[model samples]
Target: MDSDDLGLFGPGSVTWKVHEEPILIVAGLRSLYLQSLHPRAMAGVAQNSNYRSDAWGRLVRTATYVGTTIYGTTAEAEAAGLRVRRRHARLRATDLFTGEEFRVDDPELLRWVHVTEVESFLDTARRAGLPLTADEIDGYYTEQRRSAALVGLDPATVPGTAAEVADYYRRIRPELRMTREAAETALFLTAPPIPWKLSLPARIGLNLGPPRWAYFGIAGTALALLPAWARRMYGGLGLPTTALSADLSVRALRLTLATLPRRWREGPLQQAAKERAARLAGTPA
Candidate 1:
């Protein structure tokens, strides 16, 4: 379904005022990436016939990341992380979440879905702590166009026309406030103005290519293992500082798995992995 159909938020709407706008936006973008990648890991979890019901249980937990990481206290965020992870472990390898039995096969539709989610994601990042500049926001839009190509959509056909693109933004305008002007203002207020600089290591980490063929499971493994020190190291290297947060780490796994190859990973494998992981950890299965 198109994000425009969600009607989740409104203009100038900040999910959590306590978190800086930029951080929240980044969090949102990260969340979108995870969502885009969900099918990958689903294979590792959907092994049982009842996988969908189990997955729904897990999503309810993962959704909490949006609340605790961006709005609640640190303790709350940490707690939520545990809850999501615990539920994730319950997924069955042979089963699928309640809805789709596979990742969307249409490349164009996937690209459009990715773009919409990324916009909302940036909105979340803005709320968390990103003091993005107009140039940076424009850059993000440009990059999304490129990313659309990665998933198999013609950039030229995307949005079809400037009017279409504008309409897309207008539809989500209610949930966002970091307009071209506001983003510019935030950038100007920072100690450094346009022509921003990112350290070499930071750039490397931030641009780290997507996972190998093992994306579905490995990403979740990496995220589940993410500790405060890991986040610090990644942050020190130049990724968004919030990327190190526990909530983000857990989410990274949840969404990545969802984007797996439909034939091999979509159903049973996804569920089995979740249950297997939980069993290994002796949590619950």
Candidate 2:
């Protein structure tokens, strides 16, 4: 790690604070739920993804990409992004609705994935008791356009603020739906196949009992955190109190995770980046 390199965000950036929170695990899942609602996005994943067979590996790789963008050196981040772009360049998905095979990496589909992802991170952090003001929230979105750019999106074409994201969602609502792909994806996320091997704590820890239900809780919490409108698309029309429950659940989840030792909570990438930031701050010209 280059102690002097602050990556894309540096220490002062809002993104550094927002993405560090453990609650963003829920946020990542929320983004998947939200992104799947787009027909093209769902089709792309349903057709091209191997998430079902390699669920944990897929999750780790996704997390690594996100962490690299936030914490790795600029070159590392760019390299990771380039790898993704090349992979996506080769993949195509056939959307039955469009009756055509389209590149999965199209800007429009990428934009939807990008927007929903950042929105979920911002929303989840705030709801889990992070103290971000309105301007900071806007700044987070503005800063994330750099992330959008790395994935081959034109920064100017992506939403740059919370207001813009909200408006974009409203305009795109008509195109969003719970298609067969999205439905199956959502079902799998709620109860994803667990890897047969697990340590002792994972088996009975978290007080959630079985591993399956434990993961279901995590997924359900993410589902609960979805915007009510998105929830409705998935037949989550039960009650208005779901919002309150989600808020409570997220807060509790964050609190529980916080109890663990720092090493347990913070991954190597995050720790290395923060150390670099601190090292640079302590040195003089």
Candidate 3:
């Protein structure tokens, strides 16, 4: 069978391995924190998106887009990409600092979003004690170039290795800062609106005070996982996390998430992708 007829990344691909893990929820959070440091990109989100009122919806949509691109059939992936490109084409935002209008589809801004996400996903997986080699890590980045292309980025121009990612961060550091919108975004991620099903229990826990503290604790762990320089940008917005504590927290969380039942940890999309790959390999499914 053609590779496209199989899942986009297939079973052997590092993208599949990294994304299939439940720990990626943390990675997704880390990516958002890192992305918020970019004023223009963050402005586009603040001005044009309903992230404040519908934070969970925004997260679900982003996860869906990623799931479709990485595990869906080729046609499905392309269609999703087209939808995003069309939406971006019509959206415009004014930079808060510069007071200049710009298209959301601007390649530079797209690149910023793309690089931060890919780096976050990979770095989180590794730091969480996922066993990935140097070459495998590089391979994962190389594979993700296909993902970047779907969102209108040129794969060749995007960083495809750890060294390149570090250099990209160094070059882009000057453009990043902590703004009011960014600080607000961080707070939102920390204590987002709870889903209705758990509202009563959550309220009870909140009344007892443990839930609020636990929520901030989890949020702090997510923030601590960010690169040192990125964490520094947040400045006085929150308490600083030492590298040693961050490492222990990530590893412990990964270990805890690993104990979840396979059915609970692997979503239907991921299970279907694995079955597709098995069939393509002529193995029992």
Give TM-scores for every candidate, taking all chains together and pairing residue i with residue i.
0.28, 0.94, 0.92
Model 2 steric clash pairs: none
TM-score of 3: 0.92
lDDT tens digits by residue: candidate 1, 1-285: 221211122122232221223223234323333332333332332232242334334443444444333333334444564554454445433313344444333443344455555554554444333456655555455544533443445766565333455575455333332233323322222212112243353456654233222333333323223223332322323244534453454445445434655453323322333344455466774
lDDT of 2 by residue, 1-285 (tens): 455778899889999989879889999999999999999898898898889999889999999999999999888889999999999999998988968999999999999999999999999999998999999999999999999999999999999988999999999999999898899989988877666565444677633347666778889889988988998999995467998898899999999988989898888888888888878888532
In model 3, the Cα lDDT at residue 102 comes to 99
Off by over 4 Å in 2: 199-208, 283-285
Name the candidate, 2 or 3, with the larger lDDT value: 2
Error of 2 at 202 (Å): 12
Top candidate (TM-score): 2
Q: Clashes in each model (backbone N, CA, C under 3 Å)?
A: 79, 0, 0
Query: Listing every candidate in turn, what is its Cα RMSD in Å to the true structure after a full C-alpha superposition?
Result: 22.4, 3.0, 2.5
Off by over 4 Å in 3: 1-4, 201-214, 236-241
Worst 10 residues of 3 by lDDT: 235-244
